[model samples]
Target: MRPETEADLADMIASASGPICVRGGGTRGVHLDGAVLETGGLSGITLYEPGSLTLVARAGTPLAEIEAALDAEGQRLAFEPMDHRGLLGTSGAPTIGGVVSANVSGPRRVSVGACRDFMLGVRYVDGTGTLVKNGGRVMKNVTGYDLVKLMSGSWGTLGVLTEVSLKVLPKPETAAGVLIDGLSDVDAVQAMAKALGSPFEVSGAAHIPRGLNGQPVTMLRIEGFAGSVAYRADQIASLFGGMSVRVERDPETVAKGWAWVRDVDTFQGTEGDVWRVSCTPSDAAGLGAKMKLAALLYDWGGGLIWARVPEGTDLRTRLGAFDGHATLVRGAGQAKFQPEPAPVAALSRGLRARFDPKGILNTGLMG
Candidate 1:
């Protein structure tokens, strides 16, 4: 089922009799048994204001279109959303609604924020076929319920988003990456924490235990004016005086390198189940050590761990209890998301009941 208009979408949901699988771009590797509701029919950019640093696009508007428009104005989506096509091997144009639905933020998320942070407004259809619009096209909109945020990262379980308004940032004049080699996972986390804490403004930090060349590399990114970028890179490199640090100043090289980290390209085509682990930065190395995975990639300065283990491995069982959560990003036979605490689980159930009384939207996808 595909609806081209907001009213049509609402009506379609209202009339649906069975479970519905909400899909946008078809790139997230989500599979479920239900009637497919494709949002691709609702496409196009509705508004864009370079001076105001804002953009509004329909849910199915191709992500590339938005980025190209933003680039023409020397602006960009500050959250640095990841492209799942390479990692998931899905062939479809990513859409703005998909990004918002998944709250897909990339490496710069450590410094800027997640996709939800920049969201200004959203228009979606709830389970009962009601059209809901919350927030607005401004940064300081504080009217009623903050449903704009609630819709984000909801994975379309609550509603199907029709349009979204976002805040954008000016593109940097230049960017550089400082690469530190030969550091163990523990040492890499420590170095990343130090770099992030420094006043030099590191925008991206990641560690690949095994990179394209089959060597360990810790990357730190700085962006701004050319002179500022170069100065900050030198300062950050100097912080690790005795370590092997190489500064990459070429704009294209820096962008490509960070894209690699943002998309978890290290494990893109590799064999095994992939897990996305979120924990306190200081506890990352300990958790990784416990898992003893086949490969590892650290992002967000160690706050996020991507582990590749043998297929059908239940990583949460091996790690025992910790102050973090492990999510299965690839492979099956186990739950994908970590089980919420009792209190949180109750609250989640309550919200779902309230939003989707019929429980027809993307049923059982989250679990």
Candidate 2:
């Protein structure tokens, strides 16, 4: 029950006999079932070279503070991690280290990649009580291995990340989203694919399938300068012809529109079972084709699907058709987890074991 300072982590690891969870702000507290290693006290920015476009901060620093400082200089962490303020019923002050530990990348992930991409270096206390450092403040060649990337989405399973260094990108001059309405799941996927492949860079494309009575999916987002976005919107519109595409402009409007895509305010399925299914866009349409009663929808250009089903149905059988896997997001009583970790996941686990031999961080979250 102690807050880990830079020096204290080693001692903390030495004392713990079993697995340790790298707790951060306790934002996702309920999701874990282990000894908590709270990270909020490990706060403050260590180094920020604005000219270098790289910054280093303690793992426990609040993400909002990081964003505000970067925003002041017209720069930002490109992956755009979403704040689970509303969803988890906790303060939106997610720690920067927590973001890295969980790899909380948002819609911008479609373009800039995830939190792992910006990771330049890390300082962590591994299991068996070892404090190690890797990479550098600036990007360059590595001699052999890279644990920074390994810990990006490890969900604190490997080691307790104490400090993080990342390269940031300037915020776009202008950003906007073109909401192409009425297109069913099939048409939306085709449209998103087309926009993403075009000359103009469409940063994000999501096909939010109609849910419940009349909720329409918030379609594609195209960023960059206003003129370029408008031009791209027109070119893509030609493909749709008569279909009504609602184009939204300005940062405020764009921010409001992306709320759903960001999973900001819509975590209401807490009352029932919610499943987050990740699959290729091609298979999404057919995977849940037989579910006559489940309330389901799609997002992230149809690659991420959200479904809330009646309590008793077996999720493994229901979502087996889709080539991808589903992780339970809400509601009661079941181990609907993907016990068989994907090949990539096993490789990730190996990397974790390499960094954390004692299995003293986020033990069962990975299992």
Q: Quick one: how many clashes does candidate 1 have?
A: 0
Q: Give the clashing pairs for model 1.
A: none
| Tens digits of lDDT, candidate 1, 178-252 | 999999999999999999999999999999888878899999999999999999999999999999999999989
lDDT at 325 for candidate 1? 94
Give all candidates' CA lDDT scores: 0.93, 0.74
Candidate 2 global CA lDDT score: 0.74
Q: Return the top candidate by lDDT.
A: 1
Every candidate's CA RMSD: 0.9, 2.5
Off by over 4 Å in 1: none
Off by over 4 Å in 2: 31-34, 211-215, 288-292, 341-353
lDDT of 1 at 263: 85
